[model samples]
Target chain A: MGGDFGPGITVPASLDCLRNNPDLKLILVGDSTILNQHLGENLSVFKDRLTVHHASQQVEMHESPSKALKNKKDSSMRVAINLVHEGLADACVSAGNTGALMATARFVLKMIPGIDRPGIISALPSVFGHTHVLDLGANVDCTAEHLYQFAVMGNELVKAVENIESPRVGLLNIGEEDVKGNEQVKTAAKLLENSSLNYIGYVEGNSLNAGNIKVDLIVCDGFVGNVALKSIEGAAKMISTLLKEDFSKNIFTKLAGLIAYPVLRSFKDRIDPRLYNGASFLGLKGLVIKSHGGADALAFKTAIEIAEIEVKQDVIRRISEQVEKSLTLSKSA
Target chain B: MGGDFGPGITVPASLDCLRNNPDLKLILVGDSTILNQHLGENLSVFKDRLTVHHASQQVEMHESPSKALKNKKDSSMRVAINLVHEGLADACVSAGNTGALMATARFVLKMIPGIDRPGIISALPSVFGHTHVLDLGANVDCTAEHLYQFAVMGNELVKAVENIESPRVGLLNIGEEDVKGNEQVKTAAKLLENSSLNYIGYVEGNSLNAGNIKVDLIVCDGFVGNVALKSIEGAAKMISTLLKEDFSKNIFTKLAGLIAYPVLRSFKDRIDPRLYNGASFLGLKGLVIKSHGGADALAFKTAIEIAEIEVKQDVIRRISEQVEKSLTLSKSA
Candidate 1:
C-alpha cells in the first residue's frame, strides 16, 4: 500500500521485526485482500502478535501533499497514523509518499505544545559513529523559534538514542564565524545561546561528518538539511561506482578484488546507508518513523526497530515536557 | 600572498601553469622581495612573460570581508583584480579570502548589465563527466529574481567553458515537483520557463551526480549550494577513511590492497577533486577565479589552467552579450 515494494517488503520486514523484538506488536494497514495474498503461508505463525487492518486506498508516490490530505483519507499511511492517534498502537512507521505521510500524520497527530512544526530527524554515517541532523523536509522555511525548538528536541533525541549525558547542538551555516549566515540562522544562534541547552555555535557542512566529538545534533531549515542529506547520498554513490569500475577492469584486477573481498566488505559495511535507516518526524504528538520508499527487507526491518526504540524511550513525552518547560521559562524571563 | 601556503604554493603553481600553456602569461601581485625568493632560480627562462607587481598587504583567511575591503587598498588580491578590471590581464586568479575577494571584485569591476550579484560557479566530479554548480556561497539569501539571474549567468558559463550547444539547466530543489520548493524557488521556475535557456524544470540533490543525461548546470541560492558542495566533500572523505581502515586490518588485507593497487590508483585519478579546482565568479565585468586556499601545487596549477580556458573563450564578453539580449527580450515581451 506504501513504498516501492509495498507488501512485498513490509510484510516480511514486520514479521522479522516481531521475532527479534519480544514486546513488539504490529498492526499492518493496507488492502486486506492483497495483504492476505502475501500472508498466505505465514499467517498462523504471527497471528497473535500481528494484526491486519483494512485500508481501502493508497497514497501514490507522486501525489501532491495537499491533494492527498484532501482525498486519500483511507490510505494505508493515514490509517496507520490514526491507529497511533487512537492509542491503539505505540508508534507508527511508513515508507510511503513522504509528503503525503507527513501531511496526513500532522493533520491527525498534531504537534506537541510549544512546538510550531515537526522536523524530519535522521542520522548519517560520520567518520566514527553517527551524526543526527534535523529539519530534513518538515519546515522548509523555518523561523528562529522553529530552529531553537528543533535543537531542543534533537538534543533530547541524541541523549536517548546515543546514551550521551549532555548532547551538544550546532547550528548549520556557510561559515563558522559569529557574523556569518543569513538573518534567520544568526537570530537562531542568539536564541540558542540564551537558552539552557548545550549550544555550540555554527558548524560548516564540511565538518558535519567529523562525528561524535564535534557535535551530537546539527540543526538547519529543512531546505538546507534536505540538500545536505541528498548530497551525501550522491557522493557515496559516485565513490562506490568508481570503486566497482576499478575492481573489475581486467582478469588481474578481478583476481585482486577476490583477494581484497573481506577487507573491502568490511569497509562497505561501515559506510552502508542501511546501517542508518528510518528518520523520525520530531515534534509530533505520536512517534512516527519514515523509512526510505525504496528500502529492502533488511532496511525496512531496521526502520521498524528504530520505531520500537523510540517508543520504549518515550520520545514524544520527552519532547513535550521540554517544550512546555522552555515556554514557561521564556514567559518568566 | 592570499593562500594558506602563501607565495610558496602560488609561485610554483604559476610557473608550472606558464610552462604548460604556451600563450599564458602571469602577473604575480605580492611583496616583490618574498615573491623573488621562490622565483629566484627560474627567473631568466620566463622573465619576458612573467611580471611582478609589489603590494603592501595580504588579506588573512578569517578577516572580515567588509573590513578588508575598507582598509586594504594596496593588498595583493586587490592589485591582481585591478589588472583584470583595467584590461591589463585577460583574467585574474586568487587563492585568498573568498568573502573579501567577492566584495572587492564586485565593487571594482561591477556586475554585468541586467544582472544583480555575481555567482560562484565551479565543477564537481560526477559519474561520466563533470557537473557545474553555481552560487556556491556568493549570495546566501537570494530572491526569485536573483536565482533567475544565476541561472542565466550559469547557462552562459557552462556553454563557454564546456562548449555544449544547449546545456540542460536545472533549478536545484529538495524535490522534483513544481510545488516542492519554497516561495522563491517556485517563483523562479516561472521566470525560467519564459526565458531563452534549456530549462529542465526542478532537480533533486540525489540525482545531481547521475551524469549528463539529466543536467549540466545546477543552480541554487548560495546557502544551499555551499552546503551541498561541502557535504559532497565530507562524504568522499568518509568513504576513503573507511577504506584505509579496512585495508590495514591484517597482513592478508595488506596483501590484497597491494595487488589491487593499480586499479585503486586509476579509480582515485578519475574522482580526484584537483581535476575540478578553481571556481569562476560569474556575471562579473571581468574574469576572476578563486582557487582553494589550502591547495597544493598540482591543485593550484589546475586552478590556473581553469582561468586560461575561460580567458581564451572570452567568458566575460559572452555573458555581457547575453545579458543585453535577455534584457531587451523581457522589455519587449
Candidate 2:
C-alpha cells in the first residue's frame, strides 16, 4: 500500500523482522484483503504478535505531497504515522513517495519542541564505517538557524544510536576553509562553534564518504544534502555497471570475473547500500524511518531494524532534551 | 608557482602536451629559476615550442579570491591569464587556487557581453561516455537568470567542443518533477523550457553519473554542482579503497585479485578521474582551464589537451554569440 510493491514487499519484510526479533510486534497498515492475501497462513502463526489495520486510501508515487496530505487521509502511510502519533505503534516505516511521507509525517506528528523543522537523516558508507547526513530534501531553502538546529539534532542522534559520548559534527560546504560557502553556511558555522556540541569546522563534500576527515555527523541544507547523496549513489551505480560490462567484454575477462567472484562478493557486501537503507525523519515528535522506495525485502527489513533501534534508544526524548539545553544556553548567553 | 607540485608537475605536463600535439605551443609561467630547473635539458629540446614567462609571485592555495585579485598581480596564475588577455596566449591553464584563478581570469579577460558571471564546467564519466556539468564552485548563490546563463554556456560548449548538434541539456535538481526543487531551479527550468536550446527538463542528482536520462549537459548553481562533483569523486575513491581492502584481506583473496588483475585494471582505466582532468571557466571572454590541484604530469597534460581543443574550436566566440542570440530572443519576447 505504501511502496512500489506495496504489501508484496512490505509484508515479507515485516514477517522477516518479526522472526528475527521474538519480542517485536508488527501492525500491518493497508487494505486488509491485500495485506491478508500477502500474509497468507503465516498470520495464523504470528496472530498474537501481528495484526492488520485497514487503510482504504493509497498515495501514488507521483502524487503531490500537499495533495496527498489533503486528500489521502486514510492512506497506509498516513494510517501508519497516525498509529505512531497515537502511541499505538512505536514507529512507522514507509517506502512511498518521499514528499508525501514527509509532509504527512510533519503535519501529523509535528515537530519536537525547539526544533523548527524536521529533517531526513541517513547513514552513508564511509571509510570509518559510516557518516550520518541530515536535511536530505526535507527543507530545500534553510535559514542559518535551521542548519544549526540540524547539527544539534544530528549530533544527538549519532550519540544515542552510535553510542558515542560526543559525536564530531561538521557543517558541509564546498571547501574546508572557514571563508568558503555562502552566507547561510558561514552563519551556521558561528552558531555551531558557540554551542556545547562537538563542532568541527567546515568539511567539504568529499568528507561525506572519503573519510579524509573523520566527522561522525555532517549537516547541510536539504537541497545540498539530497543532491550530494544522490550523486554518490549515481557514481556507485556507474562503477558497478562499468565493472560488469568490463568483466563480460569477452570470454577471458568472464573467466577472470569467475575466479574473482568470492573477493568481489565480499567487496560488494562491504559497500552495499542496503546495509544503510533506513533514513530517519529527525526533529519529529515521533520516530519514522523512510526506506528507499525501490528497496527489496532485505533492505526494507534493515529499515525496520533501524526503527527498532531508534525506538529502543528513545531518540525522540534525547533530541528534545538536547535542543532544550542548547536553547537555554543561547538565551542565557 | 601554483598547485601542490608547481612546475615540477606543470613543466613536464606542458612538454608532454607539446610533444603529443605538434602544432601546440606552451608557455611555462612561474619563477624563472624554478621553471628552468624543472624544464632542465628538456627546455632545449622543445625550445621552439615551449617558453618560460617569469612571474615574481605565487598565489597561496588558501588565499582569498579578492585578496589574490588585488595583491597577486605578478602571480603565476595572474601572469598566465594576463598572457591570454594580451593575445600572447590563446588560453590559460592552471592547477592553482580555484577562487584566485577565477577572480584573476574574470578581472583580466572580463565576461562575455551578455553573460553576468563565469562558471566552471567539467566533464564527468557516465554510462554514456561523459556528461558536462557547470558552475562547479564558481557562483555560490545564483539567480534564475544566472542558471539560465549557465545552461546557455554549457549547451554552447558541448556543441562546439563535443560537436553535438543539439546536446540534451538538463537542469540539476533534487527531483525530476516540475514541482520539485527551490524557487531558483523552478524559474530556471521555465526559462530553459522557453529557450531554443535542447532543454530536457529537470534531472535529479543521480542523472549526473547514472546515465538513466542520457543527459549531455547538466547545469546548476556553483554550490550544488561543486558538492555533487566532489561527492562523486569521494564515492569513487571509497569504492576503490574498499575493493583493494577486500582483495588484500588474505592470501586466498590476493590470489583472486592477481587472477583478475587485467580485468580490474581495464575497469579502473574506464573510470579514471585523471582522464577527465580539465575544467573550463565558461562565460568569460577568454578560455581558462583549471586542472586538479594534486594532478600528476599525465593528468595535467589532459587539462592542457582540453585547452587545446577548446581553443581550436573557438569556444569563447561560440558562447558569446549564443548568449547574444538568446538575449535578443528574450528581449523581443
lDDT of 1 by residue, A1-333 (tens): 788999999998988888887788889899999998887866778888888999999999999889999999888888999999999998988989998889898999998877888999988888857789999987779998889889999988888888888888899999889878999999999999998888888988865686325677899999999988888888888888878888888898899888888888888888778868899999889989999999988889989999988888888888788878985467567
CA lDDT of A219 in candidate 2?
95
The top-ranked prediction according to lDDT is 2
Interface RMSD of 2: 0.8
What's the distance in Å from true for residue B151, model 1?
1.1
True contacts kept of 2: 0.86
Note the residue pairs that clash in candidate 1: none
Per-prediction interface RMSD?
1.5, 0.8
Tens digits of lDDT, candidate 2, A257-316: 999999899889988898899999998899999999999898999999999999999999
Q: Write the per-residue lDDT of candidate 2 for residues B244-317, one digit (tens) a residue.
A: 99999999999999999999999998888899999999988899999999999989989999999999999998
